[model samples]
Target: MTHSRKILVTGADGFIGSHLTEALVRQGHDVKAFVLYNSFNTWGWLDQCAADIRGHFEVFSGDIRDPYGVRKAMEDCDRVLHLAALIAIPYSYHSPDTYVDTNIKGTLNVLQAARDLGVSKLVHTSTSEVYGTARYVPIDEKHPLQGQSPYSASKIGADQMALSFYRSFETPVSIIRPFNTYGPRQSARAIIPTVITQIASGKESIQLGSLHPTRDFNYIEDTVRGFIAMLESSNSIGEEINIGSNYEINIGDTVSMIAELMNRSVNIVSSDDRKRPEKSEVERLWADHSKAKNLLGWEPLYSGTEGLRKGLEKTIEWFTKPENLSRYKADLYNI
Candidate 1:
């Protein structure tokens, strides 16, 4: 019953998007990858994937903020997976203007182009950070959105714009909100990569921020599966679905587990630079993924510990290579 349709994946060079591109190719779908434009023409994590997998993707380099480029990328495509955005919360603090331009306006450009192209489906990526600190446990779609930081604020604007297109113009869009996706090829700005890299580098002390904040971490593959599931399920249109593992763990506990698995005894020191602003910090996040399960027949396949082990192993392996480790700025705080 699979349609022989061309799928356009924006941000296909990113962590989740790269994984999604591989998944789609494995499922026998034609993939058009819209990578971010750069002078060096880099494809980010997409470069790390196997050459055969890379061969399967038709890559087009362009900026998401450009409407003409976005429209050209969507040409002859049946579905669009919009994953491009400025996601670094810490960087957003210093440059909120960039977030608004990229997260909000970029999404608007994609939506308008998709509507014009009459794409069969559009899946817009969102983050659980939009919900900010949990007012209640097991946050559902009904939870109030608090823009605890500039990054979340921009995402809120983007999500609202996507949903509005769905409601007002029947744009056939689904907002896929994923909670803390962690795995291979993730930027060092993420906690998992940061911890794994520091440990792999033979550091006796690992620097981190507030470790009490809890998050529901979905493995990258499962998060990408949720995106594909939304595309395949007609019921997902006009609906915002949460894709998460539903299990929450404190950052302190997560680091401890990694330490044990890595067989390294390291002291964790809280660095002021690593901590989010007191008012901006999100204390807890646990997703209510029932909507995704019932609607898209999807749920996280990897448990927290299991996913962590896999992520750490892969990250450690990658960072062990000098070439890969050189890509990360382990000496400085990313945001």
Candidate 2:
């Protein structure tokens, strides 16, 4: 099932995308990283990738919203992993139009190029946020997608657009729905990094939003492995698979565990600015990854509460480093 491929990973500049790009390069695949265009000529996290993979892969700077740029970056690439999108929920509140253009139309650009170029496979990234509040425990692919926030709604549009190509043009598209991936190089906007950065900054009291909501967190390594597994499996064509640790923990308990791991006695303070609107908040998410295991022969190595602790230990260790901790503004709330 393993073979050399010319792969293009859009949004390769971001957290998960950078890890995935490095993983692909180390696996001996020809990698083209399509990072967002910026005036500063920055490549997001890829600008700071490990020295071993510093020049191992190609970087294509462009905007996913541009069809011409997308097509150009995807040229001659056999596989495409679409990860670029407007992901911040709070920013989406007042700027929903940007989400539509980036998440929905941006995805359309990838689908169009994949269809026109006749790529071998296309893996579209989907978030657990699409499932919303989880109508039932251990949500699976069949669970109805509810776009509680503009970010989630846009992703739902993107997912349907990808699926539409498969049904209409028979594009080899596979959707990978990853639940709350966390680890090193993560943005402080996310809860895990938020807590780690705050505590690492010598804060006795942590500012958070809702502590009652629960999430199924997967380590970055596991999430990257899931993407590779999805790419390798022929059965993934036209299928949507969930990549998760299958372990649920409330935000409060997760913070407590992180504090214990860091050996810090910290107080959690609820911040209104960080909390989502009453209707927009995704209260719970618990993944049933049996489909991924049955289809792609993939499952999270970090698969339970014990696994979560191990993952957090590593995350804390990384974030506590002086060089890494200095990059984040722990005092500021990321909206």
Candidate 3:
């Protein structure tokens, strides 16, 4: 928040990118938002953000897979936060080539552009999925990465490409690996939104997949702050830092918690269509955020119940709005 530099955010139209872009504008930074090009001239989540924040952003339409477009977007920017990628795990199973093209090759475009443009810092977004199932309690940076799904495999490829640029060309890069982030504007393909949408749409019985897997869910606001804090810390360059609440809860318990927060109870049914293939599912993920704290002075500000309440409130508010809930087909399985 100190120096107001030109920050380029790829995937500014998506959930996390849109929030990060808005956060940057609120912090008084000049932002250039790179959104995917389309014939409709759609801005995605950027369309829903405040006018003042949108006014501060310079919107450009282009594809991240195009190196030329990526470089053009980075021009005159002091830093870059790469968030564009194919994020749906189930979709990746069908079109893995696209995931590799976007996540891995698209990341290559960003890193190459940053190195060529001499950007001050590049904050690359990573996911906890890269660790697969947790091998030990509080998974840390040193934990072995297991690519259990095509989505995770592509992310692993992307992370390595960014790190290689750091080690080889000395491009200033920090991998901001955030655990599961949920909040308003999230798509129904994700768990929290799926649950909230079902309840909002008046479903008597909630259909879910495997409910045993546990995840460390960070509220979107804290995740955004973690990105800024990581970039602000000079010591974070060339380091991979986790941004997550240390606490985690199982999916079944999370459903109960959400129901409790909403003051509604419903029977939960396991749906075969919602479940992941046995080999592709990640059983557990818990974050060891000690590195982030010791190095970048970062820690999650929201605990589970607090974060869940905030997320569920916003999600319920959004879904209850006729226009917003219409985007999701709650009667059918998203995967």
Candidate 4:
């Protein structure tokens, strides 16, 4: 947790990963970012980061599914922040095998390498989806995990794999489960970005799926700070902590709020194609952050309205740009 120690971040090119990586650099940590390798030589969201922040990173491009590549990336790093995985639920329904490979097997690769290399700590990223629909409000760590979809199922496998490393091999590992983080650089596959991009693109009707499902949304900065707090706390080892705002809002209301924030008027159209299978959709999520506060002294700074307003403002600003808007196909549903 010392700034002097080197940290390796997998999925550094992603939305949360990029923000976390930039924050680490700004705090003067020795950062090595493991971005997914692609022939385009693109660094995804990392490329959108400020030049100064990107300059501080020791970027390594490789696939997390490859054990050899993962080992090479972890070599000499004091800690690992593993966030690489396939996260889209709709896509998982069609290509469950790839989800197994990337989410489960990729996590196995990180665990094996961390165990072998003697990393001080491995902060494995987890999702609220692993909890599925909350049987009770303000779900705690003790909540039962329901694999409602292949994506959540794969994450369950990954979370268990990380815990197994901690129990079996005594690997220094902690699970940071964040709920519905939204912010700039998020992909169109996510609802916030999907709505923002569609509205920014001048769409008159917003196409969406089931709007009744409630979610506990956390801002990017709060979620990133949760990761750091986990890394800094010795008590966090062998623990699974939830990082969320401990608030819930249904999808329809959220869309309305976004529209109000953007000062845009549009019709919300329920698209049959956007709805998830009845059994697979997670109906509600409300986090219990007491464990996180008790263990790591971590608490979210942004209220539900404040976080959504700021995050959406930033995201809308980004998407309003011709170049950024061009990257998204607002007319087409993304997964």
**Per-residue lDDT value at 35 in model 4:** 96
Q: Which of candidates 2 and 3 reaches a greater TM-score?
A: 2
Per-residue CA lDDT of model 4 for 200-259, tens digit only, reads 888889999999999988888899999999988999999999998988899999899889
- Which runs of model 4 end up more than 4 angstroms from their true locations? 1-4
The lDDT values for all models are 0.89, 0.94, 0.89, 0.92
> Which is the winner by lDDT between candidate 1 and candidate 3?
3
Q: What lDDT tens digits, residue by residue, belong to model 2 across residues 164-226?
A: 999999999999999999999998889999999999999999999999999999999999999
lDDT of 3 at 270: 97
Candidate 3 lowest-lDDT run of ten: 1-10
lDDT of 1 by residue, 132-206 (tens): 999998999999999999999999999999999999889999999999998777888999888878887788998
> Cα deviation in Å at residue 13, candidate 4?
1.0
RMSD, model 2, all Cα superposed? 2.0
What's the TM-score of each model vs. the native? Answer: 0.96, 0.98, 0.96, 0.97
Measure candidate 4: CA RMSD: 1.9
Location of the lowest summed lDDT over 10 successive residues in candidate 4: 1-10
- Model 2 residue 86 CA deviation (Å) reads 1.4
Find the candidate with the highest TM-score and give its number. Answer: 2
How many residue pairs collide in each prediction?
0, 0, 0, 0
lDDT of 3 by residue, 220-244 (tens): 9889999999878889999998888
RMSD in angstroms between candidate 3 and the native structure over all alpha carbons: 2.3
Q: How do these models rank on lDDT, best leading?
A: 2, 4, 3, 1
